[model samples]
Target: MPTVPSANPAEHLARTVDIVALLERGRAMSTPVLRAAVDRLAPPMNTVSSYHFGWIDAQGRPAEGDGGKAVRPALALLSAEAAGAAPEVGVPGAVAVELVHNFSLLHDDLMDGDEQRRHRDTVWKVHGPAQAILVGDALFALANELLLELGTVEAGRATRRLTTATRKLIDGQAQDISYEHRERVTVEECLEMEGNKTGALLACAASIGAVLGGADDRTADALERYGYHLGLAFQAVDDILGIWGDPESTGKQTWSDLRQRKKSLPVVAALAAGGPASHRLGELLAADVKSNDFESFSEEEFAARAALIEAAGGRDWTSEEARRQHAVAVETLDAVDMPEQVRAQLTALADFVVVRNR
Candidate 1:
């Protein structure tokens, strides 16, 4: 595994702290507005959404720390700062983006049959999919309300971005679901699919930041491009990590994707390699074999499959892809008319994007 850039740790730590503080303030303004709108839409479920949002507990009691990492909002803020503006200029949009993201994740866990999230039982797992779906709806409504609360003028750029990104996310999810039954897929196509699914949102984060930062259309577009490429690179890295990452630290089982027969970037690349293990990967894909039977296969089976990915140049291909996208991210950051120190911080963050070993 490639070593994580030292810059990443530093930037992540600093950004995380700053973002957490920012969220603390944003929540105070945004949450009440969100709750009111949600209540207006689903008076019956108003209580449920409130509980899920961490306004209360299962018993409808008050609670804390119900909010998630708020990474999308953080990205929005960062994009604003990168463009030489105060981060909170994008506050409403940032909160909307985050709510939308969480909304998706809530439904995603239910659809994927996932039980855990953020170190706890997923909302669906605890509350059931029907309720979870309602919560998702609430999230969307809250997001839209947040956009509306930004007022006609303040909402112009941010709402446009949120709408575009939400569409991209739907398209990406459609493509991902379509891939489940697909037999023939290319690495390039997979990149496109994931780019829409994963890349669009990240792109939205940066784009919103720029738009709210009062950047010109050109600079905003550049920031959007940066987000798009970064999103792609991040997903590519995630696909790699999904297969090889340590279950203990990554909180994912080893070969989880293999077990699911997921045609992730590495798996597709291995199939394209056409070596001995490549042939086996083809056989497995063709025949629909199981990974729990991994021990039953040839002693060389696991190693051979991994070798096929390497031999077929899957890792290198992915690494190059990451580097390429990261270059775009840096390019966009550089193009922003921000202070040198601010730009440097963004650079450090760009490097951190694809430098993970996890």
Candidate 2:
């Protein structure tokens, strides 16, 4: 049986050839369509939208760095290429996926009470919850509107695909919130929730390009599976980073997920291990929760908890799981016949998903 790839930091870094550059290229191609759609919103709504996208400051001045890595748009365009279509043919789909992604981020930040994102105050923190909610709704609506502009039949298909994915995404978020209140959660349950919350949108982004590019259902479905597995790998890596990443590099507070008591994959896996380390972790977590002292942990205590989690094998398990999911993602690509260059790019993107540090 094939084992998970060894974690050679150098090898991983070697494979990590600036996937962000491809994402940026896709962003450049799709930004005009996205801007036109957002501009259709009312005055303050447009302003809030612009701020959230990192195009402008809270004071409505044009500032750089409003958006994300544009990963979804890149996947859309790449999927389109894999289906034997020009990347431009996927522009509308790319824009639609990106809009929906930002909409989720806006709402998620509010729901999670996250004050900061990408090293800036979130929309809710800067603009208030009501405006944040409104802008999120507007973005979702605009995504649909943009898709419909693709012509009736294609628009209808894309809309159905996106809406179904959106529903699953919402359900996943709901499950995630609910998990926080529960005393015990299994790894299987955690995976399901992450798959729904993170995987659904990525699946849509990947398949939408194929649909728009006139690929048959089989090719689109294969790409969707590829994205689904890739999403799982992405989230698993993100879970690892949440606990161990550099605050300066990840642009978040140190141990941010643990600070929030989030039941991320590694945390749940640690809890489920049911040994001395697991018991110790549970005690620490419970103490924090019972005393309402989540913020009071010293660096030493945090380090101890992280060590306990590693001893419980949570870190190693999650890392291997990420590699396993990445392997599956690459395998799924074989189901479709695409240009070698496109296939290589997609494979590289899959490797980057598991190996990325931030």
List model 2 lDDT by residue over 68-131, tens digit each.
Answer: 6677888899989998999998899999988888889999999988888888899999999999
How well does candidate 2 match the true structure in TM-score terms?
0.93
lDDT of each: 0.68, 0.84
Residue 213 in candidate 1 has what lDDT? 64
* Candidate 1 per-residue lDDT over residues 1-358, each given as its tens digit: 4333333323444344433355455465455545666676564466666656666666667877336544456567677777778866766667777778877887777776666543346677667788889878778777877777666653677777788888888887777766766765788879888888888988887778667667778877877887888888787787877677666545555565554456778877777767776776677566554333444555355555666677777776776777777766666665667666555555555555576554
Least accurate stretch of 10 residues (summed lDDT) in model 2? 1-10
Show the colliding residue pairs in model 1: none
Model 1 spans > 4 angstroms off: 1-69, 289-312
Model 1 poorest 10 in a row by lDDT:
1-10
Q: Give the C-alpha miss distance for residue 41 in model 2, angstroms.
A: 1.0
Per-model TM values vs. the true structure: 0.80, 0.93
